[model samples]
Target chain A: MFYGYFNGTIAPTDQLAVGITDLGLLRGYGLFDYFLTYNGRPFQWDWYWARFQNSASRMHLKLPLGKDETYAIVMKLVERSNEAISKTGKATPTDVGIRFVLTGGYSADSISVEKPNLLILAEMIHPVPAIQYEQGIKVILDEYVREMAEVKSTDYKRVILMAEAIRAARASDILYQKGGEISELSRSNFFIVKGEKISTPDRHILHGITRKTVMQLAQSDFQVEERPVLLSELYDADEAFTTSSTKKILPITQIGELTIGDGHVGPKSKFLLERFDELVKTW
Target chain B: MFYGYFNGTIAPTDQLAVGITDLGLLRGYGLFDYFLTYNGRPFQWDWYWARFQNSASRMHLKLPLGKDETYAIVMKLVERSNEAISKTGKATPTDVGIRFVLTGGYSADSISVEKPNLLILAEMIHPVPAIQYEQGIKVILDEYVREMAEVKSTDYKRVILMAEAIRAARASDILYQKGGEISELSRSNFFIVKGEKISTPDRHILHGITRKTVMQLAQSDFQVEERPVLLSELYDADEAFTTSSTKKILPITQIGELTIGDGHVGPKSKFLLERFDELVKTW
Candidate 1:
């Protein structure tokens, strides 16, 4: 009973469909953003909206609706999703994960852009296992960089193709690097801590909202440096972690074959996750 | 009146709809191949099918139907397309461009793979004007390399985003390069002729079927080198051109600000195009 907003109508997500001639499908010319809700409320509405707009603008797509109108649509979908879930006999409504996909619309010529199609989807959130968050997760390193790194385009073929290799390596995700410089993960931002300082790559990577929040939270306790991080820095790093809408601050103890520090969850990431939880609880 | 085959059903292409949960639309996890029909028959069917299978294999997508079954489906769509086009009162039916799109099917979780969705489309062929072929088209050089360059995946966002710039520069397409070596164009394979020799990049390209045909045709008259072509060599080349399913053999007279050898179609490209036309006419 998950719900989604396609163009102008709200329908069952499973029934929502896009026409065959969409450039988004034929040419992969689209952008998307994902965010979470806290008690049925959008955790960081403004930041998500701004990033969505930035992605659209960077990709030369026109946003059909203004901020207020789009916000109204998201809220409506949120309400509908929770109501539908409650009907399943749950005593309490659960927080939902929201995703916004804006694509270069249906084109008579498959290569050209038409009116953009906007799909806002609401689905049940699946939290990462507590054990992974507590004990830390593993990541593999890949020698590649994403095209249009600043924009969240629907071009995840490399990551999708790496599924087998990731599983074979007993890794949960991949950290990308190009020309000896580490960039970011397939779907999240990477950070490494050394002594009391935190560092993350600033160039050729997505400017993640969660990464920004963690940096803001770390200002008082640790020194944060946003610059190009070298691949050589990972071998002896004291700690490492990744940030995303779903994985706020999942620790990374193992990278491919290298183990970070004592091969356990680090204190800085735990501290930042606690701070993030506190901030979101208030929201 | 255009028709398409989605999964197993044939319908008007405009009415063909893919589910919203498809990884093709959500994550761009798909591969595509397009070839033209000559006299209502697929030209070089074996080569095209082989390349499509290679792309699918590289992208980790499984084709739902085998070659014989898929050929039956394609022939059905082709017949339907011609029948519908003939209804428009034209005395003769037109040859159509056939495209095969294989996507990483619908997934409840947007990131995982499921049964692949196969879409076969038949559309009117739009040929480049003879004037452009005579005068030659201009292309701009881009300092980028495609991810999974050998696969025909649906990741054309960079090319789509460069549309405005291409128009501004009065260019027909983009030629991608990495680390000072020219690879290929946005939608075609690139080549340069020096004296009685022609060379095209052997790595980081889609290995276009048309490119193979042109190389084979030129073997009797010219030395064909399938190796990395340097960007520095482009400036002084005697002639340059591109090959694609639609364009076949279109000459290039300009590369960004440089006018290639007096800015007119070169004799080598003309000779090759004439050979290609003769070869196709016999089919």
Candidate 2:
């Protein structure tokens, strides 16, 4: 369909983002969010906006509009995207994902200005490759600590750089560890399933949308304690997986040189993934 | 006259700065710099570009061209800018200041792209209002901290946000004190002139082009210590000033309720500003 939302309207998926002249791009002064819509209706879109608002507030950024105004803009764009998809026959089941990105607009070369540009964009749900889920993925631990691991700003150069360096050494993902405790993955929330209980690093992750959904879904199946999981915990865990918007609930069969359990998808990860699939449809 | 150096052959100012794009605007994943051109040539552009490259490398970002190629682009842009200003009456008298900005070029929705959109814009010197020199400015401290204050990324969301929020608070500038350490002003480096010694928290501020220049220029006359400046020392100074490309050496007359050095320009700040003017012209 029409990939996602932009501004206060929906256009083609290909036309979702903004121009390069925008200050957000010019200065890296923008904030964004990645979340999914449920059956054409954005699941927790309001919550996404809330987090976006919080991000802007944290950065002391002004999101062109208030909460209600921002919500209206998102809804309008989402509906427009749905229509575009229907017209183009790209609507696959009408269920999709959304990304809400906001920028500080443009600069007139002036230091102080009353108005700043506001940009928003959304996109569709692209399933992660089937290979990653089946065989699981390998991750490496980043020895050095990171800054701004809490906020979701566009300045992800270090995150990408570290991940690429890790990949060059033959790893799929890079996990940030502080002292001896693990924080989160570059883009996903990490979880360790030990015995029958499940635990994960708290907001060390992006407080991921999928991570939150998984936490809610697995409340009954396992105990979900929000805390930092050390690399030692990973070595002893029965299974490990990551929760992200796109990956949903993904298994981590191997980390560094060590294999988890039998070195394949563990029981807990599979059960959690099964439950995640069911939750997304309802969510 | 057009602000930046841009003409037929060379891009003029080289700071790995490139054109604006969706990727750069939305993500702030780029490198940038502003350096003064001595006469028609760059003074310390090379020094600034070194940090730009370091920032790019730190991010594991692959620039569009090698170091030499990028420098050529800047030289080209500067030539163009000079030609534009040559048409103006003050062309000979006017000096040049250039901004080098580069963006992560466009990609197909995915973030992993190898290429980047390069844009270089050069402009004449844009100094603060003349009145600011005679009468120092006021500043407010930011409660929260800015991480990686060293990276010269286009991410000014926090700086902008805090400035906007405190507009009504009679605060002219803002700087966050991280864990009780006075980190830096929003867009400039923080310094306090205590007697004959000029002290500032080393490395907590932008390794600013002007800041570095001022340090080198004043090293013979002033004892420059690059140690941490505590918040408690903010009021104890005879003078306080910040260094940046735009506001080379600006003295702060007041911080909150305290008026620094009899509420006027201190002797040390006055000398530095005077010396800074000569440094830029001769460099």
For candidate 2, what is the recovered fraction of reference interface contacts? 0.53
Look at candidate 1 and tell me the lDDT of residue B154.
89
What digit string (tens of lDDT, one per residue) describes model 1 on residues B1-283? Answer: 7799998899989889999888889998888999998877898999999999999998888889899998888888888887887888875455888999999999877888979999999888888989989999999989999877888988888888999999999888999999999999999999999999899999999989999999999999999999999989988999999999899999999998888877889889999999999998877
Tens-digit per-residue lDDT, A21-134, candidate 2: 456766676667777667666677766777777877676566767877766666666777667767766544466555556666545553443445555555556778898888
TM-score of each: 0.96, 0.83
Error of 2 at A272 (Å): 1.9
> Model 1 off-target regions past 4 Å?
none
For candidate 2, report its TM-score: 0.83
Cα RMSD, model 1: 1.8
DockQ of candidate 2 relative to the true structure: 0.37
The DockQ scores of all candidates, in the order shown, are: 0.77, 0.37
RMSD per prediction, one decimal? 1.8, 4.5
Residue range with the least summed lDDT across 10 consecutive positions in model 1 chain B: B85-94
